[model samples]
Target: MATDTTTFKHVSYLWDEAKAAELAGDEVALLIYRSNLLGADLRLTNYGGGNTSCKATAKDPLTGEDTEVMWVKGSGGDLGTLKRSGLAALYVDKLRSLKNVYRGLEHEDEMVELFNHCIYDLNSKAPSIDTPLHGFLPFKHIDHLHPDAAIAIAAAKDGKKITEELFGGTIGWVPWQKPGFELGLMLKQCLDENPGIRGIMLGSHGLFTWGDTAYESYLNTLEVIEKCAEYIEQNLGKKGPVFGGEKIQSLPKEERLSKAASLAPVLRGFCSSNVKMIGHFTDDDRVLQYINSNDLERLAPLGTSCPDHFLRTKISPLVLNLGTDENLDDVAAVKEKIAPLFADYRKMYEEYYSTCKHPNSPAIRDANPVIIIYPGVGMFAFAKDKQTARVAAEFYTNAINVMRGAEAISEYTSLPRQEAFNIEYWLLEEAKLQRMPKPKPLSGRIALITGSGGGIGKAIAKKFAAEGACVIINDINQERIEATTEEFQEAFGKDSTAAVTLNVTDAPSIEAALANTALAFGGVDIIVNNAGISISKSITEHSIEEWDRLYDILVKGQFMVSKEAVKIMRKQDIGGDIINIVSKNSIVAGPNNAGYGSAKAAQAHLSRLLSAELGGDKIRVNTVNPDAVISDSNIWAGGWAEGRAKAYGITVAELPAYYAKRTLMNEIILPDDIANACFVFVSGLLNKSTGNILNVDGGVAQAFVR
Candidate 1:
């Protein structure tokens, strides 16, 4: 459906000659520009999947003589966001000289270590394994991209024949080979056999294009991809409904999304058995069409053809065979059936690993599937972080497009199981995994802090996000939400936090907010009931309306929020934490504070009640009681400071000193102090404790728990 009506579809020519001229003389700059343009379109390549390079003559720092250097994207760098610093510069002559040491296929991996010796700049980033692929090519500029359209032709059963027919030998074909020195040599051999070919289609892999200039290579790559997409589109137009027509009708939009949200937590739980995982859900038309089609059963089990796709989505996806006839709303029933489905999938994966693993293969990683396809609903992807989960889903979508194009022209052919295993368990890949930095304490956890627009709520949100938790900052004030969201985005990445408007006292509002949170970052793992209101008046001065407002926000608000969050936590089947931001007044009685004190008392008791009731489910409910947090507190800003100052027979400015002098430690309390106490409960330090109250009032003895 995305095909171009006339000249192009699936991709576009986005080159800007005006921009290109700005960096005309700098080869690395031009390479970055070209790579960015190609990466801008997912149809061209998935994130961090492809590599680009250019050969340029530069001054050798050591010899002070002009030498040809190859600048290529460094290991683990993404093209779209690449900077000059992300490139690895290696001496072209030194790379070429390695041919004498190359001992053939068996010693290919050893060459990776040798690449370090060819480094033209000592400060350059580590070279990618694909360095040899670019080094062995004779062209000044080259691009190896995994475009779905190009890969479709490469993944077909008769791919080699199709390549000859599509480009009439202008584009050559090479049989399937794992990337290394051996594959690089195979490419050189192919070029030797066909001298005039514009590019080479690496079987069951991707396409490689080259040109004497950066602009030329950029154009040639786009042109070849466009041609392949057009040919596939024409063939698809003549074919029947994709994947042998839809076998099941998709659910209505609202129902479908609700079902996805309901199931995401359960799936996340299943996937996190080995380690916690964040989740992503998508119901894009392509995914829906594939999952609802007749061929899903056959094609999904065959697994992804491309290595990039295989790496992200694992060897195969687990397809859930739920039908429209089932009760979509009965999440509990669906939950019961899904466990065995996941069990069966893990069993199959173990069998696959056992069948194909070599003696040197790395120990099996988690057997849980990274991707799960639910018929009539959509696809779900889980990973150790939010971005990876989302990107995994995107990569799988690319796989779906490849399948559609390959099936339209020729029967889709997946990589052989043994080959897929080799890549999945490659020692180089294991080393890459081992090199990753240790995950943060709160990595993969999602936290929702109510009233996070300012004050104590904001502090908790910042702390959680800094600890690597994806935070949902909830408040009724849209303006404050936007401001705080922007601030967090600048500090942590945009994906690290989401903002939502919520009124915890209102049931529908609470439901909508939680649903949105689930949609934003899968589901809730922690809830900080920090939303509150205060009316510091005596029993006689406090009107019924004022009393109700205080109770509504302080007592009922917390109960409603915790009630909704627990549902998600229970479904997740993972233990969770709920921290209530109660006040010291909850225990120590004081004058002219009837409404505020009673509401705090109710909230504190509610926390204890929930802790007792929810202990069976491994959901901890704890309380943080603070006496006075005058700084950055909206409660103090809104006349409560004056009321408290009057009660203590002091000025508003003296309120801080008054509250601090009364404490045993004689220390003033701050919002961050309260946040720290909350952290102590949810930070896994107190994972086994529940129904506990951590007072953060600078040691207020009167407010201490008995």
Candidate 2:
């Protein structure tokens, strides 16, 4: 490569002193602030794609003297929301000392074992694989990120020459090398050659920048990345459609959901190259454009631009045999082609492994496609679980962004098969996977809660989410649906759950919502049939219209939802759980409430019949009956309370206290109390439990079951 001295550079910094002040002086606090700031910009990195670290002084364990320590981002920490506890601190001197006794290639696994044993504080955490890189560097702070602009420059054919001209000798370059003790040694060599170098660009890898202070490190990264961005913008110049001659593959989510759901099971089975696998669908504008483009068949198979992306994305994705017009009618065709697809993909992967297997590298992981792109319909990521699947999705998204920017400048180029294999099979990245926490009991399950606006249903949604279930907040009110959806996403994650506007009584609406949930979350695992309406009227005074409306929303609604869920669950061949949130009046007679009592009674009976019939299929059915949940119930606020108050010859204001006193324990049931019993039925904690009625009425003898 020829070194040129003339290159135009333009870079800017977004620094806020107030933001820095928010994080106290603690080393972890400063690191957290820096990590969040770097992660805030998708242009810098996306999701869990970057890492940050700092060196500080800490009290020694054996002696009272102070010693140097390195606090690096640990294995499972997310950069965007990094906290003080997310950082793991280790003895800087001790970590670098491992290089002396470390055997060349075979010792990589032992090196990581020793790295964990050198923690400065036992209470700290298991240090990350890249801990040695940061510890070996003689800097207070270090940052490594997969920025789009930087990655585009690093993967280019003329990366070395362009970087030399752009940095003006202020930054050094390290050619593509696998990450480990060797890579750390190479970076140390770059620093020794170029004293006071701002950063180093790794070919087809990531960029590493360090500084005496966190602010300096952050600023240098921003400026250097901005310069790369400028170079691409200047050279790429005017461009045609990023999708080549193809148009955006924008399709209505509803139009494609049912088809996606119907075919997800087949694809999931085919792509599963291990003991377990999950499928997730995503149709982000960019994703759709990439998979549906005319150039997809040519460019997508090229591979990832960054080595760090290999662990999550693998060397190449398994492109399904569907095009822009993929539909459910093709299930038979898909089923026929799926076997050969897997056979061919595995054959290719086996060939690659045999051809490119390095003596030092570990055996190739299962040759499954972590990513699957189906033109028009959208893209799906297959992983061991939902969280890992989301990570693959984020990696794929970043890969496209880099390619889009790079191809415009020249051609999108990435690491070849051999280098990709090294990183994918690296023991360091493998250790990260082995260290992941066990899945929660409800992991990979989906729960749909009706009347979830603000009541017992909403409480159930929140509780199920805590147990690792993806929640679908279904309600007729758009405002409530939006609010509840935001709350679910905040509690879980952006992709953990979805919300749909639905009227339970409407068959089409219920079908659409079920399809939406199935498409987004794969399929339903738990159905909480809690949506209903209450009308307080004496049997003689209640009109036929009242009975019809109550049954329509309560009895028929639950039936429709359960019927739809059973179909999907049966097809999944994975037994499911169904919980019906019935009223205490279902069995216990209540005064002046014939309509609600009769509907709830029918619902409770319906659950028993369904339980008896579905038990053969391994589906559990149960009911939770609560008496008076006075707080946050829409039925109470929607005039049912006032009517009941009038029946008791009391004001609505006095009804709550009266109901509280009526309970034997004087305990007014809250929405969460009902939520607790509802989750018991939904969680399958009682695997043998079926046709059981759990009550939540604070010891009301009339509501007690036999």
Candidate 3:
């Protein structure tokens, strides 16, 4: 029978009898189905925070005898995305036998390597640290989750007392212990001592529930969380004004976001001192409620209670209390104070490491805080990439929920300082970090390419994204922006790129685009001034309006975009690249192209000027000159092809062959060829050289830089 959805109030009941029935009898499949359901709701477990397992009888290959085997989630796998291949299958007897060789708590880490010997299936995924916790339980089905409500109770000052009162001896309690063989033994001992307990609350950790079948375990996990959520909700309603009432009024929506945009670049720069970092900003109601509250100062440094939470958010966030109450109007003034505070934070982090370091501690990592809180604004999370930064922000948000619940019932408690450090710099964790795939050259870089709807701009965006840079696809048409954004989102991840509609000649539009880029991925590190329009006509035939339009797009557009982008790059204090896609007409001086050719010449000179001016700030500006790029070009589609063909005494369709023949190398230029030239400048190959022009005109001697 299907579980009645109406019984559950705090959490969603997504289990469908018909759907689950399809996966029945296949125990591993049922385990995956149950895990997916639990993980589907963040209320149950945040991303990659929990694990589930089932013990089933499988055929032993060597003896062809049926043996009990444990299939548990592998290290680093998310429960929601769990698959058969994601589970590490091990022989139950082999895992149980390791208890004989266990050398006590001091040498627990060695158990990790021993786990490999217990594999029931060849080529199985690596088992998680919590593998023994499930393997020794002796339950047919088990669930371990980090549900916020349960964690709130777990992290509460009176967590044990509350558990005894709430469940009345049905749920047992275990003191805070870092995950390892020791904790697993502690869990087993608790189950043995409390013979009738339905579950266990892992103090300062999470919850553990079990049952004789998959359905029972899933139902028990949900019921426990739902009951806890109900209790938290009741207590919260009784308590007036969470976090001792809001200390600072939240800025209005538009004003709040505008402030976030203004401050993000500066903060991003400070955080990237060690390595390039991406930033994520959230003004979610929960974040504002906490940061704007009086207790923010106290709780911000206390840090997160859950291991998963601190692993992502770091031990503590750096809270900035800019002098003014709520008015952050003087952004420059506020920015000035941020640097010294950040320096203090770095010093404090280093001190913590030095004090906590053991003989075998891993070297200190980036001393900068992963999370930064501005009371009236919101929270900003920084990491090595967009998705990681976003996830860290989410983990901090979960910590906020836990804190709210714990405070409503009892005082909220963070993990002890030594414990937090132990987990943060664990040798096993250091090994995992070392095992990660090497980062791509442009891994942490963010690029904004204008006129990327199609043509050279689109090609450049693709190449940069492929090389691991997050891209912002900008175009004048909304449809093109949507299409390109969707395509990039599919190819890369949703976090890998964003889209903006822009008209570069308009200053306000340019500012809005830059702001959007800041909100999307901290700030822009590479600017490709590719937005352009071509008008091919004789000087006498060209209307003044045509000439102005050409200049507005090709020349002034590049100037405006560069002008705005440089401001952000300067605030970031990180060197950046600006690549302008000019045309060979700038120097070759082709006929019937007066307006286009003059604008191209102006654009080329602008690159040189900016290269000279911004060199002090380490900003490199370069230009790429491509001639007769007729294939997949918006310029050719808009009557430029016809005009150019007329000037060259050929039909529109003959332009490609005719233009190619005119080049010294007889090579026809494609949009990708121009994109390659842009990469050459931004790929760090020409780091020292600037104020130069590279001609991509199939070796056109006349267009060569003199």
User: Which candidate should be chosen as best, given lDDT against the real structure?
Assistant: 3
TM-scores for every candidate against the unseen true structure: 0.97, 0.82, 0.97
Residues 59-113, model 2: lDDT tens digits: 8979989999888887666788887777788888888888889788546666777
Give model 2's TM-score versus the native structure.
Answer: 0.82
Clash count of each predicted structure: 1, 0, 0
Question: In model 3, which regions exceed 4 Å deviation?
Answer: 1-4, 237-240, 323-332
Candidate 3, residues 203-294, lDDT tens digits: the string is 98999999989989988888888889989999993667898898888878887788888888888999999998999999999999999998
lDDT at 3, model 3:
51
- Output the lDDT of residue 450, model 1: 94
How well does model 1 score by local distance difference test? 0.89
List clashing residue pairs in candidate 1.
4-9
